[model samples]
Target: MKNTICPKCGNETQELYDGRCKDCFFENFKLAELPLVLHAKICATCGARFNKNKWANTGSIEDIVFNTIEDALFIHDRAEDIEIYFEPRQLSPHMYRVKVEINASVMGMPLHQKLKTEVRITREACDACSRISGGYFEAIIQIRATNRQPSPEEIQKCMRITNEVLERMHKKGDRFAFISNSAEDKDGLDIYVGSTNASRHICKEIESYLGGSFSESPTLFGRKEGKDVYRNTFSMRLPEFSAGDIIELRDRVIEVRKFGKNVTGTDLLNGSRFLAPPDEVKGATLIAKRSTAANAVLVAIENNELMVLDPDTFETVTIKKPVLLSAKAGDEIAVVKTSHGLIALPEEVSRKNNL
Candidate 1:
């Protein structure tokens, strides 16, 4: 090993970096370099920040300013184990002053420097925010029932699904996945979505969970890129008869257990499982809700009928016993009085449903 002397300072030292001793090297080295001012593109509506040509969630103004300055900084490549400290102050609504401390080691020597800079928050709506502000939407979701109006709870469920889908899409960097507006109508709910694909996804989710079907229709709205642009409308039809609804179909009292592409239920009169098409269920007449069915006392079970005492009327009546009924004589059971006659419910269904 040989000792080297710094050419500029003429000092003799063994620790030399870039043909200069540690002291001279550090003296001439730039600890940190940054632009005089940094610009931050922030959305005024959603408070999202634009970074690297993308809109992203950001922290407070001070934190954003500090981060912007730190990102734009260029530390010397020779500096090792570099650390930065930022002390920021709000100078005005649009300007921020930040004092930065740079600490690092250059060739086994400690180097420290402080730099002051300013950050200007340029308020401009990001792409998504701008579209939202202008009431822009690419698709509309119309949730309607097959035969009757949807219940409020059902509509709320659809809205919740929409929010969950939007949140997931947003996290995946789909900034256009947003709901512009939602309106409750006489038939169902209308949800305006910011993206056509998102609208389709929302409709699928609603159908999968809520048991329905949806179709898409596109209409020419305008032209883009020298071509015609079209927007979509997703019409989602929910089942008219939901679970726990009693309906008269095929001259039999049926209880709807589930409804989707195929309607599944149990015949309340004969206690036989039933499966039919959505159209058949739609044509069926809604008699009463399973929620309104009353409890009854099973006193006697004949070959094909059972004598049950109605809890409300306190009268014993002979009703058809279902094959699926598990209750023995003298056990309490659910009974629904239909227009034709009284029907005894199976014990399994009684335990399964709250009613």
Candidate 2:
């Protein structure tokens, strides 16, 4: 027996089970079950999520998983991992987005700078030829060749190198997106995506020339503001048709008490005090409806809408009228008019969901 900590639940494992014990191991394994369509940058040491900051020097992968602190890394381990990383990372549980950089080429060619892969070519760039020639030009070329936090001079050189490639390609009848690390000059060392039709041709040519680079991420370079990357915040929307989910079914309001007319909506808990559009709520499957005597089951909803239990049984009313409950089980449900439809939601997921 050995002791290991479940990184997420922070529970102690009594045996070595997939780096965790029996009860705690399931969470990690479950992550593998879920489609991995999301990629995120995290701290190599503390496992804290990374954004709003630049990172480099991630450690190499072992098979597909990277489990080393000395290495800054990301691991995509599944079928969906090929297209886009898939994992529900709650920027806020209800709202999520995935970010990743492309790896390898369409031909499946490997590019390793460390190994000096001949497939990875580095040509002396000449952007000056492009800028001076107006339309027909060769881009500039510069390099830091030294490692001291990639100086402004180094980045400048990288940008010039990028331009040179663009220039050479343009002359050769190519129009691709300009991707870069970052910039010294906000105006110059930036990214640019070409026209749709021409872009396809140019991108192909560039891919054929330079496969991949550790210093560059085309995805970041092609970052489309306000749309692809946004301060977007949204909640789940329940289905309105075919009824897989509905609102006001298991709607139980906790911590409600008599309050003055001036009491703000915040007085209600267990759910939103102020109602949002029906589309903004989570859905749950409608289970068997029954009736029972339960006091304090009524609550106010929307504008002047009262959710009250039937006086006789106080349970979810079965439309077309049928009774289903065992008296020995003390099973009693609240009966009320269903305004929203029902959606089948997983038990575990629904529990974790707040929306």
Return the top candidate by TM-score.
Answer: 1
In candidate 2, which residue ranges exceed 4 Å CA deviation?
1-148, 176-190, 193-355
Residues 1-355, model 1: lDDT tens digits: 6877888799888866787776776665787898878899888887788999888877777768877997999998888999999888888989988889999987677889899888998998889988987888999999999878998889888999999999988877778899888889799999999988888888888887778789999999999999998889999998778888889886888888877668888887666789988877657888777677778889998898899997778888888777777788988888777787778766545434211
**Top-lDDT candidate index:** 1
Q: Candidate 2 on 1-355: residue-level lDDT in tens? A: 6676776567776654545555554334322122233234443332233323533222332211222111223332421323222222234422243322333322233321111000111122123222223332112111222111333443444445555655665555442323322223422232232322223333333223221111222222223545553111111111221111122324532111111111111112123343333232324233322222132233322232333334455553222211221111122223323333211111111222110
The C-alpha local distance difference test score for the whole of candidate 1 amounts to 0.84
Residue 99 local lDDT, model 1: 88
User: How far is 105's C-alpha from truth in model 2 (Å)?
Assistant: 53
Question: What 10-residue stretch in candidate 1 is worst by lDDT?
Answer: 346-355
TM-scores of the candidates in the order shown: 0.78, 0.15
> What's the CA error at residue 119 for candidate 2, in Å?
48
